[model samples]
Target: MKRFLSQKINSIILGILVMISATLFLTTNGDATIFHVAKTGKDSNSGSEISPFQTIKRGIKDLTAGDTLLVHAGTYAEHFFSWETSIPNGKSWEKPITIAAHPGDSVQITPGGGKAFFWITDPQAKYLVIDGFIIDGQNQAYHGFKFQSGPTHIRVQNTEIKNTKYSAILVSIPPDYNGPSPNTYHEFINLHVHHNGSSIKDHGFYIQSSHNLVENGIFHHNMGNGGKFFQASLSGVANYNIARNNVFHNNSQSGKWSCGLILSSGEGNMGYNNIAYGNYAGLCILHRVTNARLFNNISYENENYGIYVGIASTENSYVENNTVYKNGVYGIFIGDDAKNTKITNNISYLNGNNSSDKNIGLQKQTGTIISHNLTSDPLFQNAQEKDFRLKEKSPAIDKGEAINLISKDFSNTPRPQGASYDIGAFEDIPQIDNIPPGIPQRLRLIN
Candidate 1:
């Protein structure tokens, strides 16, 4: 009897070890093997180097959970997959998945294709990582990636996205089959959106009804809109987000209202330290939005207001320690029953019509604290040239709230030695040290 008991215990321990190994392998499922994408899997088999699958879609279909599908160097004109769920509808013994591009290899997904609904498989499969591919929107109406499901951890890193019709990376909660439809209230937390979206209309990534955080991303020339977050239901909170060091510029796509960074229809959120210039609107908050902070951002040279507050937006929306200049209209415009909103210690200057200088900064608004702001000329060495860095003796030097300098710095440019922090997106670094040679002076008549 003692011998029989010992054997049973040993068997249980072995089973537990197998389960743990499976879990670890699932999380780190990439960085091995080479999978090619052609037309079909049957083109070649044996999945080893001797004979690899031709297409990644086939490998994904035949793959179990914890599989990594690697695409080699080439261009794939196929529609890829449109199914929302990464988990196959019928598969059981599988794990989460990761698809990556081979190192030093480029996999291009050319668009103008089908209305493929889902791009990167299922959203329900948490811990899904898709990395290292060049996705070309090709002037098409489809998004580079369409995500649907509840992902505790989803990563799309080190990828280049260009010329997409909708958002390049789209994450949304699908119609919850179990509950009533439209139960999308969770956030896409810890998402790193970087180095994508070529122009103004090329939206980088959008979060609908998700309080996700995006960091270290580049959003350039996406004329449509940069990053968007909204909730269908207005009860929950989109809090504790950090958007820093991202550039939102050249979004000159002539839309009704284009915004650089926006926290619309969400509660308890923060949008700070972002550089939004040359867009239609630097930042916007509205539609029953509350408890949002707009701090330490530099918005300038846009077609309209640097910041606009829409109607029905009550208290807990604070705008402070920012620099707004040359916005073609009011540096800051408050509207639509926006009450008890705090706008303080900011630098709003060089604001007037592109045609005339009479209509200066700060348009008609109510319930705002427009205090301690220097309406005098900031005297940037070059405003229209995109050189927002303050020249020596510019009025913006030491022009901000002294309290904001304790922990954070909004100086986006390298400035002159012994020179103070300049207002706007760029810290006033000397052109000799920071500016590259022969980039052509881009000076303009901003004010």
Candidate 2:
């Protein structure tokens, strides 16, 4: 029969050339470069500059995609490096590279006595960029800035993450058998995730897959979950994310549905103009969170409830100029089964001082839209010295009612005089004062 069909096509071309040489040696061993470590320093030929490469996984195993590894700024105690299984202590990247540090100097990747600084297993290998560093996870496994399988252009800026037991920037997901695209650009600008450990299930900044962006960061005293606003892991499902104008104060001692943000899982996330105060609950917009939008934020001295649009969400969104104060509960707590929600011009007050949670600022359990607010007392000169800036005949000034929050340029004065459009998250600086005219201005001399 034609010589047995030409030997069956030459045995299918030798099994496709042995599966293309085992996929090119597993993609070149998934990448490798070794300046070799063990406290490198023996006429180290780690490529110039005095035997460099003292671990950073030997310059991230010789990077690749637009490589740029240039970490030089002190503290490098890797006692005996050997990272190859593509960095997998917690998770992420393990691929794309551009790790920097040296502009204004500040690099410290300590873990000599229990290492695991750049632990990542390729969190979706995107365009990486870890800037001015500082990663000290001496405490081990807490998922400090990790990523499991999709590192798409992730950029951690002005880095400053400590301890690490669960949340100091632990991005999730990228391994459901891969299948994603659409311009992934995970970004965290100006980071400074604090002391670490919030313990009710730690987290100071935990993101889920989706074109992400966490802006102007600063999350202090994280006790347990200060910023967990998505659900792309443990089953994956989060969308176009963005948590802007960040600054969630003393992230209250973590746990028990802790807050300062724990949007708790998936659904087109978006928490704008953030500025949550002494947390106990400054936002817990729970599971299946909806169109998520907690406008011009400024949640106050929380002891509980300054916003908690809970489960079974839909059309979910409690909008408008926000500024919920001294909350003990009820500064807007619509979770009796959140539905059709969308409360506007919000302005909760001194909140119900834990009468087991009261003061009832606007607790609607169904379809919402509480208009033009000024729920009283918006006075403040120092909400713990971080200043929420407001206090000139404050009725939250002009009883603000405009609904397009997210305008802040103070100190640079790009556009002051909020037309008294003052609401929350500061914007009441119409207190202008510039006296130096006792004798100036051509010596008007009024003493």
Candidate 3:
């Protein structure tokens, strides 16, 4: 009987060893692995379809390239959440690791008692995608998301980030680092960031990375600027970044000098087809930022300068084809030390505090061109209803020069329907001659 029992025990141990080996083999050699996480799961269970992991921390363990973690519907509360150094880098963009919400599920991340909700660190974490998550700050002093170091394609999409004390999203590389590459090639898409920056200096979205794209975003109700792009002099300067087709409204509620969109000390940055309203200022390009372009945007009802280019060393900056109306200060403010700036084909009217103020404010600037702009009311379809579209008899219709840089209007429509392009964010769609003139019916011509 004792011999039989010992043989049985040996068989059981051998079976467990075989199982372990099989698991390891599957994890390493699979084409792509998919893990699941649920609220009813336990950390001790294997990350499988049936026995899923409990916490996001456990689900992300051993995440390799070409792996995906699908988080089911649940409220994940945590303090100081982090994706640590063990995150494996993808071999290429085609093999990125994805952390996303499961189908027909809602995933939310809120701070339980921590300072920051999520922190993504390490230089090796590249080609990672985070999508379809709601990060709620809950009015606590917490940061929504922070990326310390990045390079080559870290994407965050379809995310709602709100009510954070600091910036809703920040990509910051260390000021004094000896890394081979700076943060570059990041993208933020279809994000809604609101009600952030109550305590500290916070932006709805802050970027310090080069060649990044922030598109189709809604930035509103933040205490600081709607979006800020800054380039540090010590590190590599941000260049070739683009912010397109975004709406910036009701930001900078603190009455500071923050604008709807501000680019400080950056080069080759472009902001186009954006709408800025109800902010302290609108579209401020300041602090030695050069080679920036602002075109085909609408700035209205802002408290200060509608389109402001200020500070020193600003040159080669072009502001064109924008509509500035009903702002509290100058419609287009070109401040001191700004050089080689071109302001053309914009519609500026009904701005400034009183009759003494003008549509364009110029102070100690050189090499500037102001031409082909209209100061009359653009005859919006309905001003109180926020319909800024042009009517048939409006003066701004087809009154702009042809700018090759901008081919599409605010509605993404092709420009220049008539003699020339319209002089605003919106291009007036040409009226079709639908009704024929009453050619005398009685005197009919031979068919």
TM-scores for the candidates: 0.69, 0.34, 0.85
Per-residue lDDT of 303 in model 3: 86
lDDT tens digits, residues 152-261, model 2? 66677767777766577766665454554333467887676777763756677777666688876767777676787565434335565777767676674633557877
lDDT head-to-head 2 vs 3, winner: 3
Better of 2 and 3 by TM-score: 3
Winning candidate number (TM-score): 3
Candidate 1 lDDT by residue in tens digits, 5-41: 2232344334423322232222443533334443333
* Local distance difference test scores for all models: 0.56, 0.59, 0.76
* Model 2 TM: 0.34
What order do you get sorting by lDDT, best first? Answer: 3, 2, 1
Query: Where is model 2 poorest over a 10-residue stretch in terms of lDDT?
Result: 19-28
Q: What is the TM-score of candidate 3?
A: 0.85
Off by over 4 Å in 3: 1-30, 79-85, 111-117, 139-142, 177-183, 232-236, 354-357, 434-447
Candidate 2 local distance difference test against the native: 0.59
lDDT of 3 by residue, 1-447 (tens): 234222323443344233222322223356788888899988898878799899877777768888888778889985433444355567766788777767557788886433555566765647887777778887774567777766457788777788887788787767776554364788887777889887436889888767889887778888888998875553336667898877788887646878889866767889987778888888888777788899988887898878998786687789998888888978898877888889988888888864335677889788889887888878987666556778899998888899998888877789888899888878898778899788676775798
